[model samples]
Target: MYADVTVVGAGPVGLVLAAELALSGVTVQVLERLAEPETSMKAGGINVPTAEALDRRGLLPAAERVHRETMERMGAAFGRKAGAGAGAAATPSDGRGAGAQRQMTGHFAGMVIDAGLVDWDDPDLAAHAAVAGARMVPQRELEGLLATHVERLGVPVRRGVEVTGFEDTGDGVLVSTTAGAIRTGWLVGCDGGHSTVRRLAGIDFPGTDAELTGRVAVVDMADSSVLDEGWVWSSRGAYRRGPQPGRVFTVEFDAARRDDAENAGTRPHRGAPAEPVTLEEMQASLRRVSGTDVTLTALHGAATRWSDNTRQAATYRSGRVLLAGDAAHVHSPFGGQGLNLGVGDAMNLGWKLGAVVAGWAPEGLLDTYDTERRPLGAWVLDWTRAQAGVMRGDAKSVALREIVAELLATRSGATYAVKKISGVTQRVEVPGDHPLAGRHAPDIRLADGSRLANHSHAGGFMLLDRTPDGAFARAAATWAGRVRSVPDGTDAAGAARAEPAGVLVRPDGVVAWAADEAEATPTAVTALEAALHRWAGAPAHEPVA
Candidate 1:
């Protein structure tokens, strides 16, 4: 079928791209070579910002189901008691109180559940505040949900069809696929790292392979009753542990041989998939390593070798055709950052694509896609490369891992690690020096008991605070519904200990400018308007139109 845009691959990245585009009212099509989405559970977890982004567009419920189900399995295997109280109960600082930690009992004994187990807060009320909380959903399940939503949004998806070739003809793109030939105004290659569209565009992918890294099975078990948590063990007697089951369990094959000097240049990907690794193999490996014998149900296998081709296309646009997801950048999966990165890419591109299709975006606006995303990709690649090296289990790497992982396990460490892994710590380079610049706002309850941040679209700048004169209302009108304003704060009685009075938040829910009422009228307005123009690619003083 012919359409405005055709996206290849219905994987998480591609589906997310499609859903964002469709939700933004772009006419798009998704093509997948697979007859059906994989049932194999993959993608161990997601980060905070991604959860917020998905929730902003109303897709969190479906996403949470997958995380909830997986975490349940993890809890059982880890010998943990089951209850919603697992993560909901607040722990007292003294470590003893009603809010203190709950203990595991019965079939599961002595296990404790913490913030790590909870699904994120309801997206409707929580997404706009401080990057929100992270929720885990297997990649396949996430993809299926997004694909369904995209189709529901009226964007057509053609399965079992692969694109063989495409030609960019300036005004539009002509695509040839297994299904047939079609023409479109825009073509997006969400296909993957080994993308045909990228190749056809004659773009070069530049980067180097990580040294001595090899493939590992990304296996899943039909039943995880015997397994406790995800663990990574090496011959050096070092392994990284995973969370309890109902959560994800990963078996990394970064096994080191007894004789490093005997190591060869060849790695294992070319080998035929080993018969689902036998239960005995898993039990033996666990016992030999962690002194734990856990039977496993094999799920799927993948190459985890570091393939760090940290490059976006020399350009994101080639006439009407563009690239997104792995087609644009493929890096090591150090922080479970791949899926989250792809989702953000979709969010950034969605609004621009929508504006272009809706006939409001200025010429050259889409070019910013590469300018903004490429550096982000490079940063992730570099950070992950360092992370992978630290996980190597070599003598020095193991020492570093011990120090780092210890820090990661504590409350402070968890917070620090989560922020980095979730992409929350890396602020986007928006143009401004406002107090709220490049930071997420904390969730605040208004005097009326409503949250200031909720399921708002990440397409326009929004001002949220407590002022009746309503400069926000006026600005909202000038932008034709793209800009939104909300008056949110406590009443006088509640204001004694409340935060500052006014805040301007970006479409992505990050606070762009914040101030008390006295400073809100001018300084904050200037900053908010400046952020709008920066993201919208217009002059700071230009009219909202």
Candidate 2:
């Protein structure tokens, strides 16, 4: 098969990127060894940034609805509010929906943020942000949703097709898979930690080694009541057993005992006996970690083991081959940010790759993918690594956990955790002096009462004008096919969230540039053109000077 781009792996990240490129009218193909979506939702959480990315693609409402229904039912079952569950959904009185809520609480390493101590909302900053909280959608279902969406966009995804190898011919990439050979302009490895594409491209997966092995399972318990529903930390280890009966999750941080099969080693047996795990072994680990008699009756499916081992690719790209998701980085899912981070990687890389493949992106635009995203990957790696230090059930770790929990209970302490864990604090560096520059633009309400993101479903830069002067419009017209000029209900500069006189939003929803509302000097117009040239490439006809 011949395509503009070939996405390796049919997981959520790969599918999202594929759909994104396809939506931009690019010919793309997805290759995966898994013929079908896995029945088990391996990942159960997605952060707010990812939620916003999905929203921009017009994919969030349906998934959010599914999540809301799930939460509503869970709320009924758990006797809690619809939005009280982890990564839950809540209806807001204002236009921002859940993103507008005032106070929220999040847990970091067994410690819950104290809402009374911390504002959680951070009103001053929340307005300009995209999403307020996360959505607890399972990986299996998320994959299904994205797969279906990509298919609808006319992107063909070939399952059970393992990408064995590839060669970057200095012009295009030649991909070899078990099914056959294919040609594409670019290839992205969205495969998991053990990525074949990353290996073929000779990228280094460097980071700290695993300090502990965490185990989880899906089984019928003899006495389910003994298993705790949410998260609980003890002298032994940490776990979150329920909120769904028979879907048991456990963790024991003892890398020392990983190889001993009797000790409940790492990785699942995939429901097969002697994949080096047993029901007896899982029960033992549970008892040892939980210090409870939570007996296992029958093992339905899971006997998987995970680790806090963190690794990241030295770089995100190798010639025509690029990496995303676990292929780019791997960490323990302790903070439940794996799906969120991977999805964010897709959002960040998708637009730049789409732009480059479409021939409108500036020189080195594709290079920025590695420059911008790799740092975020490294930060998350450290974030998860620090969480691991808090999680290990040991003398020092327990004492440290106590201190961390105490600090997290304070306003200053909780704010720090909430921002980082929620994926809310990222500000990718872009050229420009405006504080809003290089940040994800706010969800601004436009003149027609529609949100700014609504106009971005079709790709291209967006110029939201607040000034009466047609200067920005004149500038945007230079990049006719590249930038779309639109008017907002309020002045773009003084709009709801400290907006500028004008805002140039990248197709990926990042604020490329912001005009100073206070000044419309010749300098302002000149600055605007410079911003356009830097981001949107050189203007056509020099604005007919």
Candidate 3:
């Protein structure tokens, strides 16, 4: 309607997609039902991978203002267990339940630190001191920052507006909202787990059934000076003995038990406007497990319902309408990958959407969005499902967790998990006999007093190492209007690998082609031409219906 792209829902995911599109000069509109960002601390942490994505977009500094503060507080708690003189009360022994013992017994037992931020001495860490590691920004703060970033991009976000319906007109779609109707060439649904846009598109989210369990207490009590870190308290059955532990813990709350106890109704009733649960009920649950009176100043009510309904949509696109974030896939939040996964989807789609809108992409380029992301979404769903089972104390899940944990004790295993979960190991449509194919191009320092790392948002095909040969150089000259290249002398390792004298990289930072030095100059030129075609380097004027 008023914009080229209409984004449904103004949550963090939608805001990111909108900001990215608008930054690339796309006319974008974001519709949100909420009048403003929420104050609830629904989400507690952002893992390492998300921090990298934020850093790439240069939002890390502003994000750090909040992230660092929250992380510092979380870190203090986590560190207490590892700190000297930290007693068993602060630091529980290397404790394992059926699952933890089975999966991680004999595995390296040590304090866990953020892998992405592991190398504190790294130069980049020192340079970007503001956002150092997995930021601990609460859900509300994250939304606020993202919303502000979107507004600064000149994109208009309409809050308190709900999308009612839409129809595809073959060329564009007419989106009807509670506010008004608008027409847009494209749409992205980032409307969370229960998505209205997804329903309108008629996509099926099929998978395993959901697992419902747990009642949670979110108390804002005077900080328990003794308990700094988050801990789970457990007992033989039902409620634990006495006072609650710290401010957070997951306790089983069944409907039957609530009916038996006066204060243990279906939902918690604190002093809030909502129903209230007595401080005694909360304290008693904690005491049964930790044997302590976890003092409380304020109490917030929450309940947990885990679903194994690990789901992914059959497709991410339907003509002009598309989906991202929880709208496309959902899994248990055990590993805290839900938000990060959603953010990654937006990042991956953002560049492609820009290319398509700018007329540089082939017709099938948009098709790759579903092909690439849907599979990954499915994969993450599996991982989270497995992890969820472990969290819920399943014996089989515990055994599998222990096996994986044991394997992960090795350097190779840890590195593999680190890369996989970090989303840096992502690969896309790279077909060839080349060794670099299907692998992320390791960031290499160039010898030419320049580095590929120096480039900001280095989207599109990048020639990592270029040739000095006249024919090879001439080939690059031909694609000068399309790809960007640097001389091979820039990096020694890249130069050594240079045959036609350089390498071709994809927009997602994967190596596409590498030249063999033994090949003839003609062969090198031919290779360049082949790569140009493979990467859709033809002029943007190429017609598309």
Candidate 4:
């Protein structure tokens, strides 16, 4: 009935958040509505930053294994097809196959990025590749792993229940769920787009209207090679064929035809729950949009009805409650940034929330969750909007798409596109003189030969000391239990990568502060104390036994 944090929704974001909190020694609970796990591979593809975040938590191997298995499954599915169509019987490219590109980092609108051409050593772009390129795994599989990890942390995930409502009691929150009521220090909603907790918290979800209706389905087609060989953009909309026999993806930008969904077929109206799309409706839509009589013999599973109606919560927090994932923002699924963005939110908020509960968080540390993540969410919204804007079936939009594609052919343009879409260039504004500060700290190998990631604790900060000066070490000793000092006055041999004299990394692996010049003077020690206080509150000053 009582816990440090109660997370609503057992999706990837919620499970990850709960697990992170529990890993930080915070008691947590997860409530999910569905009694069982979903088998459908809904969300797929995590960006490079996501891969890095997972690796930082020692979760990369499992995720990569899932991705490998999924790739094999897709290959098998394609192999059984009657005819060789788009990507059927295809051999792995160097990730760059001329006009037809295979994206490992994802795409912008429909323009996929060939990551092989990228310089992974570039500081701005390389920050995203700390664990290699982007990885793709089924959403269900990812959630399953998260659930397992959370279970390992002893966090109970109660399925077949949901957060019905809650009341903020100032000090804590009284959560009302289908199972029962409970009191928790904080409540976070990661319950997908149509979130019940957000409604209960009276959060304002304000955004744009849904102008385009879309559908993605798995079907048994009479002819595997019926669709085009590659991405086909036409007067109706854009369309693409997946790797398997029946997997077909389509979009319809015709407003008049979209309105017909309300009559009885597929009502994809804005501000309404997406109705179950019928096979007949999909067939009609495909035929109408493509103007080709493609026979869909059988529907493999339920079709996903999507729209371009992007919306984000006015704010991520409301008193004792907070929101993340689709609950906090929703947008067009042009590129698979949603999962990465949501999981990143969990990675950012988890430690902050744990810090607050543990009573070491600096002033406004909790507020920064909304301040930092909200803009990133809005940035994604704008990215998706821009993609959708150039993807309108109109001549102007189509022309713009062509221009964008042409521009993407250039090195700088492609780099820019990939950087933005891969979430590599995003740098948070932290109070520091060094450019690397407030950014993701460089992964450093300590003098003891341990990786920076290995020393990172879920609830504590890491101080990387590279200089052969004991000033930073002395200052760090004052906050020893709170902020761990990695190197003790170790010199050039202290780091695996070239780094500054001293660096303090947040639990989230972001550089809080770093010294530009190495000096074992009182000035350096004083500055270290100030930085330590600014980020982790006043030092614990542990008393000697």
**Top model number, TM-score:** 2
Q: Is candidate 1 or candidate 4 better by lDDT?
A: 4
- Tens-digit lDDT track of model 4 for 51-156: 6676667676677677656566666666652212322112321112222122344566777655555444456653343343226556767877777778777999
**Cα lDDT tens digits for candidate 3, 64-152:** 56744553444464453211221111121111111111111110111121333233233222222222332555566787888787777
**Per-model TM values vs. the true structure:** 0.75, 0.90, 0.72, 0.87
**TM-score of model 1 relative to the true fold?**
0.75
**lDDT against true structure, model 1:** 0.55
Better model by TM-score, 3 or 4?
Answer: 4
RMSDs, each prediction? 7.3, 3.9, 8.8, 5.1
Decoy 4 TM-score against native = 0.87
lDDT of 2: 0.71
The per-residue C-alpha lDDT of model 1 at residue 221 equals 50
Order the numbered candidates by lDDT, best leading. Answer: 2, 4, 3, 1
The lDDT leader among the candidates is 2
Tens digits of per-residue lDDT for model 2 on 507-526? 77778888766435677677
Q: Name the Cα RMSD for model 2.
A: 3.9
Minimal lDDT window, size 10, model 4? 261-270
